[model samples]
Target: MSKQISEITSHEIKVEGKSSVNQKSSVNNDLSVFADGWAIDTAVPLDLKKSADKDYHPVLKAFLAGSFSGTFSTILFQPLDLVKTRLQNPSHHVVAATVNRVQPGMITIFANIVRQEQIAGLWRGMVPSIARCVPGVGLYFSSLHWLKAKLGKTRNQDLGPLEAVMLGVVARTMSGVALIPITVIKTRYESGVYKYNSLGGALKAIYKAEGLRGLSCGLGPTLARDAPFSGLYLMFYTQAKQSVPKEWMQSPSAASVIHFSCGIMAGIAASLATNPADVLKTKMQLYPDKFPNAFSAALYVQQTYGFRGYFKGAVPRMLRRTLMAAMAWTVFEEITRSIGLK
Candidate 1:
């Protein structure tokens, strides 16, 4: 009878063990449901949504952090770009006998512009530059972020370097198109070829004087300089992105660091690739009558100044771009994180 009692207790113990296993399974299922809900609330699937959250307030964020930022930075450092352009423009109308005593490189160019045009002269094309540049820049960033998310199916919402660059192109092209007219105007203004109180005035002046085509006067030179330059800039940026560890990419703050480096590398590369176009653009902007064809301006700069002159103002241009890029990227990240997107 005692043996029988012990055997019954053992069977009961086996039954209790099976019941515990079922209870454990139920807890796991409940945990999974909770986890899924949390993931959805946190926004795990959507990349653009994440980017928007990262942006904080969308257009306003972009305005302050992007276009406005870009424009302000451009203005702050523009004296350098201006002096560079002047030194590199390769003036053709040399007075027959003067021997061209000493061609101003950078310092003389700055002094002469201030002496001749005033402190404001250093920022000659600033209004037009910002006017055209802001809108284009706005389009470039917003569109790129949106389109890359939609097309790439980047489930993680964290873009790799290739993805970032492809998206960058989207924004760049749209911005490029929007800024075409403004670009022409900015070019002219920078070269001291024309002046207008507003972008409208410049457009009106161009239409009245040179016709619609004149508004797009140096399209070939603009495209020639910009397209390949764009490729080079993005490639370097992508490489930078790729080179960094994935862990760094996970940190939103790292975005700014990456962007700053990209801008510096891009500025250097762009200064070289597009120097020829820059020289041509400067010529057409200042003396369209003198250089009816973009090709002619290219030839003139090449023959007169040689290759070194082509890279004129590169130092300041790089400085401005690097600073702006670093600031913009850092600001964008801060804004995004402040909004709790991070």
Candidate 2:
């Protein structure tokens, strides 16, 4: 009887020991999971106590989608933009003519241009716009996030308004370098004949008439205009994000409203910032024969048309940009939310 009791006691000890080891293994597994799950979450790093933040990527996804947004928007509103340009530009005839009883809006102007130039005219500058906008959009968002993250790392917190604005300027400047040549293409194509028409025609005309430099017509004006406008856009977007309450970060229309608000501000700021460049871009594109480079064109505009030349088609530009931003951000947020991705 004593031997039987002894055996039972030994068996009980083995069972307890096994249970202890199992519990320890479970704890270790849980720790491993915590490590894997939270390691890459940008918001909450695995080791929040530790000081390592992540670097942002090339942001290709944002660029591709955003370009689609830009392209579609342009297609939808090309006519409006055309009319706006015409109103602002006003050939000697347009100026004297605009003052008369009849004036054309977007639809009418688009139809008129098409009637004269054909359907392809509506898509003028498309190639250059696409080329410039793709890289530009990618660089802008990626830089913005990278800068914002870097700045936020100072406090190990999220982006604040000031940091956001500075980041925007950096991103926009990067995009501007790529945008110059493309701007020339779009300008020439939109300007009409003698200068150029289609993308191919514009390239040849620019090549034969003025050489490669002619393609960089409004680069300086574009930079000057883009910087402040970009700064304002980032500032406004940052401000809008902050305005939303913490709980509403994931909310539907709330994000939309914030984005729209930011878009409105960006549109206004960009319109004001770029009015001069827009006129110069249009004039240089159309009248490349007269002014070859951006500097010469700007000087001519300032000297010939005075300050007013700087802001010829401010109205339509402002409206189109505002619409673009509003639509882009709203769709961006909405799509991300629906897909459980952001």
Candidate 3:
């Protein structure tokens, strides 16, 4: 009987051990499930994180983003650009003793184009405009970033407003060199001075008539306008962005609004400052024989139309440039953010 009791006791102890082992296993499984749930709730998904990692070189990414942004803005605002170009072109004359007896506004120009040249006239020189803008913006942005990085390393400090301005000037000057030919074509086409049917034809005609010099018609004025314009734009844009509320900066929509507003203000200031150079560029491109150079163009404009000649297209330029800058910078920033480059 005692032996039987011992066997039964031993069996009961074995059964208790097995039950305890099962309970521990269940507890461990529960803890693992809880931990996994916590991680799922708190951690970013691995796939999403990987996707956000930028695969392209930084300069290449900037170039692509800048190109896309510039193209998009140019397409949307080409009509405004055409109007501005016509207004700025010295070759287009507005008769002072016209039936209206008023200076022609953008509305009048638009009406004239539609009446005489059809609505499609509003998109004149769009191809050359796009051609100039894509590579120009791409080089401008990539060079800006590249210079900033190099300068930062050399200076061993964060880029300041002055550095930003210098970077802008250098970048724009470089891009402006490549922009001259396309700009000449675009300005001539928009001014209704050139009768070429296609972009290739325009290029061939310009080259055949005046060779390389004709293609680089407004280079001086272009550099003068673009360099300072870019510098002022970057300075003002950086200041404006810095002025935004910290809390608002955390919200993408709010940040975009700030960017757009700042861009408009910056663009207006820069466009006004650079309007005279822009006018000269247009005149030189449209009538290289007449204007000859930046000085000659400015003198001719001053003699013909007085100080107001320099500001003829100021309104349209402000509108187009403001909208384009707003869109381009906003889109570029968003792209950078999406690619985890910001």
Candidate 4:
């Protein structure tokens, strides 16, 4: 009886050992399969990952994006720009019986230009304007990004609102310095005071007549106008954008609308604030002999035409600039988002 019982016990033990071995083998096999599948699923090509990662430098991307935005806006709004230039020309006005009759108002001036000079004449300075805007905007955006990066970075911090305004001023000032000549040429061409056969002719004529000074005619006034405009615009836009709800900012369409609305408001405020400087700049650039310096020009305009004169082209300037700002900023923001930049 004892021998039979011992045999049964050994047999049971052998059966249990076999079962444990089988279970272990099955678990090992399942784990191996799972690991293999995981390896296969996760094995994406390095080249593809690298290709996806590669992107333009932020500054260069900003430049290209801004160039496209500015050029498109300039082309579409050239007519408004032309009318603004003509309206801003101090020489065009005739003080007749207390009312400024020769220059008239924005609508009247636009109609007269279309009637007398033809519709195509509204785009007379388009070439110079485009030439100025493309590179000017490119430089402006690139420099802005560069400056922002430099200013924003600290031991462990980023940019604030004040830093943004400072960045805008520096960026605009640098670009303005480089683009003043082209701006002078565009203003003169649009003003109808100078008759040049070609852009080259205008350059030659200005260089011969007034030297390098003529090429940079209203640089001071331009800086005065642009610096404050840029600073205030950036500050206003930044604040306005921050005021939007996070959920509204999440949707692309909603975000675009917000950006555009902020841009228009910022542009209008800046345009109105800086209209006097813009008038002075235009007058000095168009008639350098008549208005030698920015100070003299400002005084002359104020004394001759009074408070209203400072805002001669306010309507067209406001409209054109607001549209330009909205389009440029919206396009630029979209481009940066697509390119995987913040």
- Model 4 TM-score is 0.81
lDDT string for model 2 (202-306, tens) is 677677777777766666666766766677776777676666677775666666777777677767876777678677667666666686667777898789768
lDDT of 4 at 69: 81
How far is 143's C-alpha from truth in model 2 (Å)? 2.7
**Candidate 3 lDDT by residue in tens digits, 29-90:** 77776776754235534675555454567888888888988999998999998899867752
Off by over 4 Å in 1: 1-65, 90-100, 153-170, 195-197, 246-258, 336-342
Q: TM-scores, in order shown?
A: 0.69, 0.69, 0.81, 0.81
* RMSD each, Å: 9.0, 8.5, 8.3, 8.3
The residue pairs that clash in candidate 1, if any, are 54-336, 140-171
Minimum summed lDDT over a 10-residue window in model 1 is located at 90-99
What's model 1's overall lDDT? 0.64
Evaluate all candidate structures by whole-model CA lDDT and list the values in order. Answer: 0.64, 0.64, 0.83, 0.84
Ranking by TM-score: 3, 4, 2, 1
Encode model 1's per-residue lDDT on 8-112: one tens digit a residue.
999999899888889898778667757777542354456886676655654444444456546666667777767666565524332221256556555666766
